[model samples]
Target chain A: MGEIWPLFPAAIFLSFFFLLVLIELFTISLTKTNVFPTLEPAVEILKNGEFHNALLNTLAFVAIGTPLELFAGLFAALLVYNSYWGKSFVRTIFVIPFAFPGLVIATLLFILFDSQGGFANHLFQGQYWLFPKIIDHDVAWRGSKYLALSVSMLGKVWRDMPISMLIILSGLNSIEPELIDAAKTMGAGFRVRLQRIILPLIFPAMTTVLLLRSVEMWKEFIFPYILAGNYPLLGTLIEKLYGFGSDPGEAAVVALVLVGLTILTLVVIVEITGRIKRVLVNSGVNSK
Target chain B: MSYIDRDEIGKRIVWAICVIVMIIGIIAPIYLLIKYSISDPSTMNTGGRPIPLWPNRPTFDIFLYLFRDREFWGVVSNSAIIATLTVLLTSLLSIPAGYVLARYNFPLKRFFLILLISVRLFPDISSVIPIATFFVRANLHSSFISVVLAHTLLSLPYVIFMATTAFEFVPKDIEEQARVIGANRVTIFTRILVPMVFPSLIAGAIYTFLLSWDEFIFAHFLLDTGGQIQTLTLYLNKNLSFSPPQNVLAAISVCLSVPVMVFTFVVQRYMVSGVVSGAVK
Candidate 1:
């Protein structure tokens, strides 16, 4: 129905220009190692002890952060949705964290919880004296290796909770009020209404949020770099390899692996999304 | 009547508690920056640390220091220039391409869609090194333009995808009616289609600009032209190493984020709707 000429050039550009990235990936990875894009890099990484720590750190991040973000977002949405007055202002406040740059969040939170004379230490200074040896004094959360990693994970959760709430809130809003009323009329308790009516309706939204969060966490470098000092995630590892190690091949290997993981997850989401739409439509029809 | 009144009271209490918790959780962290940005320098690193919760001697000296610093202004200008160019170029490229995807049936369209989606999957960290090397060889590295182009690569896919959705929402009949009235394709697109999708256009531009603004990895490698070409993110990381004065760092952090927070507050609904359409729906 539309002219082909103008759009054709854009398509060709899409096809061609994107290849430059792929070609660059292949050529750079091979030129240095004289091996395949991932082969030597994978072998070297597996041999390195930090690789396991990075992998474990990444998994811990996703496992702890994803659920915490989702639960907090869901509860926040439910509260806002159920509230009466000033809904718009509440939504505005909910989104404030999304506005912060990653470095800003990491740095500010670091200062907020600084070990000596920081907020946590000052607030808990009384508790420390009252319960000596039982109450551990506010340790430098971002200094210890494991604790630093966990605090950075908390930072990710804090910032990302807003977008997740927004997405889930929209989905929750789309559901018919009549459906929930019907459940209540059927003598369903509050938990039953939520479990039977709300959760299924919002599953697709959760999937979208979770997938986006996972992809983001996979490439999460800035927070860890800013908050955790010398801690290495897969992302910071890429930086160290290229900038410090001067091994673009190894860095390419790490980068491509992350890409591979992301693409694989995305493919699964695509397959599931088709079924989800069908399920929602069929459920609505069957109920009628 | 009594039961309903009690139920209403319970719900109000829950809402009140939720608001309180959210305000404390989100605001308290930001308050840290405000606290340190005005903390007295004498109380920092020299003698016993002042109570960070409440700075006894608060002053705006740090803000004055950064404002006077030449390098801070350079990073600020660099960020503004790159983010501005990114918004303009992303819109120019994405709108037409999105319209095409929405209106026309082209061969390999699904293939192209998947290809575009695949671009989003790959992190910039993965490809930035190779891209940087390629750009350097072409003598394009270490410049504001290089950073803009690199950011566009990350921004374009999301913009194009969102733009396609935005175009689809503009009722087909409006465009069809325009076509029947002797309007050519360009006129119809620019005047009719563009106006209808204006909110989405704004949202897409905001997203693209923010994406470029916050991106640090690509800026790190691509704009390696000494200290002059660094973005705000690079500036922060560069200063982070020196263990710069806490108040100065806090001021820098606040400077980088206040604009973003203001933008988010203004366009909150548009952002939420855009995500719903693009991500879930």
Candidate 2:
């Protein structure tokens, strides 16, 4: 104990702030509507139509964005899995999107998807001779709720691709070359090798990607805040409640809900992945 | 007879397509951003013509304008000050704690470790209001002190993790040798252990600096009332809310991002591990 006094500083700093935040969140949220403790704040926010919409939007964001991000990362890792000339340079380039701040990426998307004369709109309208016209008129990227949220998801997924890529790339690199070589020697096709060997081996990395990316998607605030101001995901909803609505109680309630959803998603992912692993193992035994 | 392996040909073809797609998908947006920054009015507001891929007359007017702007410089300096202070604060708190954790087997060590990592589980957006409210109530809101503290809290876990790994890498024999030479604990910690772990600590510091520099949610809430304090992120957000000219926005975005981009390339190796560590453990 005498020798461990050095740990006190960091321990106190973290624990102090940690308790302060939890206490503050709970106190304000419960005491908002009554002098005594109550669940009114939670009830009020939960019953609101806006909260429901935001909840659904957040669910959709996590559902679509997490899997898409994992696939994007897996795609990138597979692309560079084989050694080639300029491989290091290509890998560095893949990280460029993530190197930029989230806010910067969202702002760039805002400009590019600007309803009128934006580059994307111009391209789709066939202003460029290199590609045929896909749409005759300009499409408003943020004109509707779906379109707005889609733009936000696009920005979120684009900016975060590198995180998943790095995780999965490391996973891919861990695969012993001898395994692949043996598969090739046995006349296993590329598709079979991928389906049977590589995919199963990289399952852990994919699980990591899913876990981390889902949490990120749930807490995504900047993209939707910037790109789809009219539409509120649960994250941006917290900002809106406190910033514009000036209701800290409601905001705290939403924040708590966001945290709950994140934990739930994590649990569900773990269980699902565990079940799949068991099924895969059982099938392999049956086939043998 | 001419025969080719279809699998070999198929792999090459797919790889080629992927390389092209990856290059264009990543590079095109960045190109547009730069073009927008330097673009002249005619190129931006073509009024109905297809906007040219390249700017009609590229100029440095926006960059020059920003360089000469006092407010822009203020925001830049504010971000620098807060980020520097965060790195300092986080290092001071994390190094001793990390060293202790790496070397000692204290009671409740497992609990402390879990507590440290789980501190990061709270979403920044959710946590910001409470932190901001506390600061405001304490009359520290809008001050650099509160923002720096919040940033340190946010980045401490990663730095601590990095520092622990760093200290663990320094063999225990060196410390034992120092003790045998009659050196005390403090002397060995400062003269031997710290020096050996200095490079990794610097890596941790760089990571902390970037985290603080790129932080927004906490800063936004803490500095919300004080119109005087603006980080680069807030400056960009404010400009965007009011519909600034495309070039000015792009220039500001470029300025804000250049430091992060530069450090990223330099510390890419450390960053890969730092990123994974933050998520996995």
Best by TM-score: 2
TM values, all candidates? 0.87, 0.96
- lDDT of all predictions: 0.77, 0.88
Over B1-281, each residue of candidate 1 has an lDDT whose tens digit, in order, gives 69879987887887898798888888878887777888886555433333545676889888898889998888888899999998987787788889888988878678878878766556878878777878888888888777887888888888888899988876677767778899998899888788777888898888887888878888998875453588888888777778767787788888888778766655656654533233212
TM-score of chain A of 2: 0.97
Pull out the clashing pairs in model 1: none
> Mind giving the per-residue lDDT tens digits that candidate 1 earns over A1-288?
346555554466555547777888766666555555446665776687776777677767766776788888898888777767888878878788888988888877666567765555555445333323433456776778887888888888888888889989999999999998898788887788887689888988988887787778778887888877567887888888888888887777777777777677667766777687788779879989
lDDT of 1 at A146: 84
Q: Model 2: iRMSD? A: 1.1
Across residues B110-219, which tens digit of lDDT does each residue of candidate 2 receive? 98999886888989998887898899899898999999999999999988998898877777877787899999999999987887777778778888888888788988
Counted clashes in each candidate structure: 0, 0
